[model samples]
Target chain A: MNLERLGRTAPAVPLLVLGLVCLIFPLLVLLHISLQVRGGYGLGNFIDVFSSGVDRAALGNSLQFALWQAGLCVVLGTPIALALVRLKGRARGVVMSFINVASSFGGPGLAFAFMLLIGTTGVLTTIWSQLFGQAEFPSLGSMIGLNAIMLYVHLPLYLMLSLPSYALLRNEWREAARMSGAGFWRFWRQVGLPTLAPFALGNGLQIFMWSMGAYAIPYVVTTSPASIDLISIEIGRDLESSVFGVERAATLSVILMLLAIAMMWIYRTLQRRGERIL
Target chain B: MSAQTVAPLASTGTTTSNDEADSFLGRWGALILLIGFLGIPLLALLVFSVATAWSGTVLPSGYTAEHWIGALTSSDVLSAVGRSLFLAVAVCVINWILVIPAAYVSVVVEPRIRPWFQALAVVPFALPWIVIAAGMQLTVKEIAPGLFGTVGLLVLTLSGVTFPYLYWAVENSLITNNAKQLSEAARMSGASLPRTLLQVIVPAIRTGVMSGSLLTAASVFGEFPITMTLIGGGYETLPLWTLRMFSGRVPGAGAELAAVSFATFALLFAVSLLITRIDTATKPADPVRPPARIS
Candidate 1:
């Protein structure tokens, strides 16, 4: 009877349908597969994932990797973001463009680049060996090295995300602090760090989730599946090995999803607090 | 007069010195960190690409263009590049087609139910890629075994994986640009809903659509695990091909790895440059007002 109501309903219905078919349906399918272990419906796969030593190790490795990656990103990215917001003109533009490129510079391409730069017989490694009289440079394939690569990929992202908080730190507040006889360190302690704490925490959690879910970089850098036992890598290995196969992979996927959702919830809460502080 | 100005002049001098020191630390210190952390590895990749032999030395012993020539001329490399490009373009087109209308409907037509739709859209980002891949694989196997290991399935998986990028970008653009007002104005002039959307809303948010498309393209170009696990049977995208090269399958193909990295860098650089150019060109013309809540 009403043209306006009809017009609105027409577009809304199709969008709702598409979202259901594409997004909601697949995730439901994933849940279904996770439930269907050994041609039956049960929580056996999840129990197996938690009870097994190797699977539990993979989960632990992923958590540790995520925590270290987030910590390192915050340590390295904050000063860079603070410095960036203080800049003006062409310099700011150039540095920002570089950060943009770096933030988007992950995936297999970045893995290859790092491999060429620091792998065994790599340029930097070769130089270190020759100069120091060592046979080989420290391997970039270890947990430490993997964390370093993850840091390089994630630092720019954290910096970019945290720039708004830095920008919100008005120069007037610093001037007022100085006028009140506060020194640099005191001002930073009293004003700067407190204001940025929520933002830093939020950014750290975002980076944590990102590193937890990363698949390509670790896949390319490590020589073997067991070399790095991240959940993502474990999922891939399970799918490939045919020992645990799709059901185990699906079970692991559900676990990863639950962890991510939990982390995302924390991140959102911190972000809201940060916004309120600003 | 000189004696009177001395007091203020001394204050100004001290302030200038302090300002200079601060600028130095901010500029040069930040630059050095960025170069050390981000730039040096890329520079090394470039050098390695041209090296005649770089083993056990800081620098390449000699340089040649042979690797570049061979990498470019190889049919396998070319086909891999072609497939990646084709996939990226197809993904971009599909995303735009799907996202534009959906963003429009949610943001303008039925803002009441936007959150429900938005939540669904963001599910891909919230869930791990492995889960999505595993789900799609099992579902596809059951539904259409014929489509398994086909490029078409890969495209579908990618569209689902990468749809959130475009959806959020376009949705933000629509909201910020006040698309609903423009649509209402068009409709008041006797234009139908579809006509108003096509002419008014689409033109208003063209830059956002382009940005989202380019970002989606860049992302799909670098995608590895999905392409490898799902479609590695018959399809080899650039990233997968690069992986094969690094696995020591191709003899003397170290330079090819370097070349692929550079090419990926080049593509990412171009996409970023275009995004910046669009941002700058559009920024001054449209001073953003805080958008009114739609519903």
Candidate 2:
């Protein structure tokens, strides 16, 4: 029972050491790469990420994209989550499965799938053309199309994050409110909306953090002049580009990691508050 | 209580009736919204997969088995599926091996360190995929040269990136399981820590392990960036094969694409059902007992 006594003889120490070593390798290697320069220590790469106009633009665009995607995910995802809790029977299972399966459908897969739906020769576009007599169908590469696809891609995660809170509401309570001459809006105002607030906030933070690191979805969806640059894309480019040093790529990566950490801290804080409120 | 007050009672009935109608409408409205959100995209994928020629039309010209046939017959496509499946299973195994022990230590050994360990394990979630891919590639190429461009690399990278899915499941089970009781009981009966773990703790959390494995499998199966960067060219997974087929409009490309999507979709659905079943099976076991004292 007292494993701590065996801690001296236990193999757990060695195993823990190995696990820690494995975990730190990637982070340390990347940091080492970031600090390495042309045979000496230098802050050149970090400077480039901050000072360069193009790098600045890419970072700005990525943040903007992340913001839009996060906002859209909440708008589209919350209603479906609400529906799942309120709706009953076999229908709920199917809907929940759809949300889960489709949520696992990544950016590239969904992008191409949507291309078949909304491309120039796509079914929806052709219909729009026939109805409106517009010869040219809009590209699926448009910002609206990209964001819409990403929103759907993220639906499952937000739904899961919100479901527990939604489940806290008792059906008997709703029925009682109805019996007492209370209507749906009256019940919702007094009960449902208030309970859902913390869930919405916590889930919204997760969605935001997820969208900020998003690369694959945007990469596969768009090829417009407006789309060629983002921090992730730039890092990939710099990694491959002989002209740019690896340190610059590393610096950009570090910046991305910091941004992600900040977002996660915000998310964790909100989650803690939600847990407390519950 | 006069005739004027009685006048308000008549309006109350009208408003109540309207409220009933509005509530009915809202419920249906909510249902329709959810249906569209989940259904439209899925239906789109299904239709696209079967479409013979979907050119500039609201619908495809016709449906065919051509793509499905092509996908099944192609050796390359078949191989990609095989590779993906193998890697996913490996990812599942590796994740469970590390996650179970790490989680056990966190849960049974020292509850004080549990939160810190959990936070560290899930750090992968917030980290960028591209960064992970890059780090994985460098690590594999330098530290484990033979692993680069192989299924092993995929298993390792994916396990690291997705282990949190398993850790979450295992931790939830451990906390709710009163693992202390089970292990204590086993130890009292002369079971060693490892045996107690293998026989008692592991079985108790089997559902969690299954769910986590399913989740990690699904993730590894669909993963692209890590597979692409770390494995490099030549050894393409299903997604990479699809990507190549996409870039180069090969003869069987459409069918290959459809096949891959449908296969992945089917796999995901199956895994999700499996997880749902596990959760439901475990549901009754829980709420039967309260949380154990933190001793």
On DockQ, the leading prediction is 1
Measured with C-alpha atoms, the lDDT of residue B227 in candidate 2 is 69
Which residue pairs does candidate 1 place in steric collision?
A: none
In candidate 1, what are the lDDT values of residues B1-295, reduced to their tens digit? 1112122333432444343366557656866887688888778778888989876567788999888888889898899889999998998887777778878887887776678766776566666566677667767777888987898888877876777777777887898798888888898899987788788888998888877777788778777777877887378888888778777777887787887777677767767777767766565232221110000
Candidate 2, clashing residue pairs?
A121-B56, B67-B255
- Proportion of native contacts kept per candidate: 0.40, 0.28
The lDDT per prediction is 0.74, 0.67
Chain B TM-score list for all models: 0.85, 0.82
Q: How accurately is candidate 1 docked according to DockQ?
A: 0.42
- Using TM-score as the measure, the top candidate is 1
Q: What is candidate 2's lDDT per residue for A30-102, written digit by digit as tens?
A: 7777767677877767876789999898788777777786776677666666667776766666666666777
